[model samples]
Target chain A: MTQPDKGPVRPRHNVKIVRKNNRMEIPSSLDYLPKVDQFVESKLKKLRIKKDQLVDIAISVSEIVTNAVMHGNKNDLGKKVKINVEASPSQVEVIVEDEGTGFDPSSVECRLDPESLLKEAGRGILIVDSLMDKVEILCGPGKGTKVKIVKLLR
Target chain B: MKLSSRDVGDVMVLEPKGKIMGGPDATVLHDKLHEFIDQDKKKVVIDLAKVDWMNSTGLGILISGLTTLRNNGGELKLANVTDKIQSLLTITKLITVFEAHDSVDDAVASFSK
Candidate 1:
């Protein structure tokens, strides 16, 4: 017997996302970065932010979350990365916390140094700082890291 | 992000769509660039016209490709960088590190010059 046509065959994605209260939690893995981006972008889009400002916010959030996952949590699958977003007409704030021993924020290398120009990494925090209006990094040895960034809508 | 590549003369043009924020998707572009390098097709042009926006991870990937190619006696250039990415390059001071062109044709033509 011939099977009924289901139109064009479409690929299926087995994606499981966890979110609550304008926040999201994911295992410390870069594989979940897109989910974080999607969650944050959805929240910001509702505020009707300008396209450029929205992009800036999204980029800043991605940078913070990446650091949380890669550096703060050391990509430990057992650890968790939490992202909380709060927004208003004038500004948006994002907080990403990781469950791992943190490092000195001042230790972050400056990518603008001539010697570091071609380095493949160490640019995320700088990019985040440049894109957001205010950035607060709270972390220390044996303490988990929490990065809070605020961007003023233009 | 989605990546597609085609050859324009001796130059390889890579078109990556969507956001290049990190994750498994970002690795696709990184691996593709290195794969091209392994195949000895090193003169590369990344067409950023279709990319909506990318975080520092994307920029790192570009730098990785550029440095790898340069070290191997090849080179990488960028074509059609969007406003958002242009701003990013400027803020990060990477604007001086890359060769950007108005179009893929121009970028391709540049490899000959």
Candidate 2:
């Protein structure tokens, strides 16, 4: 975040924050993605994580947020996406929840497949799993999909 | 994200500055690619030099452009691929698909040959 870090002079209301447990919520649409990126990056910057690693985490979270808005909620303006960030001295964790019909993570086709390689979609989970140290997906029909990812700071 | 395009000879060079996360921003680039395709501007190069980073959604946009151009009997290439994005293409094996160059000039030159 050395260069990408936002100065404190930026606007405060870009994203809503709750002191309760470090969480944020936005409508289930793609419009708020930049806010989510800034919100997550600012938190990671405070942790003093490496710049490259910070970018990896930021990109992964962005991908998940997109999936939530598009597939989970079907871009329904009425739905919402919740993001939770938790950090320790050694690692950081991000949790994303979307109000949409749940999907089976395993059911997703392999993006590495030759046929799907040039295909324009279906690489979100792959990218997230490759970048984050650990990724866990929990979902059931009508229950919504919760994706939790962890990255080691050390 | 902001996108600007110009013609370098017959090739269209699109320079997008900022993150390409999926959303309205992504849509604009996607739409612009097809817009050029409709106009029969086939030879293309996407200069990623100024882009800070992009997630899979960004990668998807590139594929969309690549495929669309191919279907139209045209071609698309990438230039100044950033390190973070290069790793992504490698990991996803898309490195085998898109033709990427070290510089925009080289990418444009390849279009003529």
Best DockQ goes to which candidate?
Answer: 1
DockQ of each: 0.41, 0.37
Any idea what lDDT model 1 has?
0.86
Itemize residue pairs with steric clashes in candidate 2. Answer: none
Error of 1 at A150 (Å): 0.6
To one decimal place, how large is model 1's interface RMSD in Å? 9.2
Tens digit of lDDT per residue, candidate 1, span B1-113?
Answer: 77778887778888888888877766788888999899999899999998999988999999999999999999999999999999989988899999999999999999998
Separately for all candidates shown, the number of backbone clashes (residues 3 or more apart, or on different chains) is 0, 0
Q: What is the lDDT of residue B39 in candidate 1?
A: 94
State the lDDT of candidate 2 residue by residue for A1-154, as single tens digits. 0123221222223444333347888877687888888888877777778889988889999989998989999977777899998977799899999988898787886557778798788888888888999999999998999999999988
Regions of model 1 farther than 4 Å from truth:
A1-17
Q: lDDT tens digits, residues B1-113, model 2?
A: 77888887788988888888877678878988998998999998999999989888889999999999999899899999999999999889999999999999999999778
lDDT of each: 0.86, 0.85
Minimum summed lDDT over a 10-residue window in model 1 chain A is located at: A1-10
Among the numbered candidates, top TM-score falls to 1
Q: Write the per-residue lDDT of candidate 1 for residues A38-108, one digit (tens) a residue.
A: 78888887787888898888889889989898988998777889999999988999999999898888788
Error of 2 at B52 (Å): 1.0
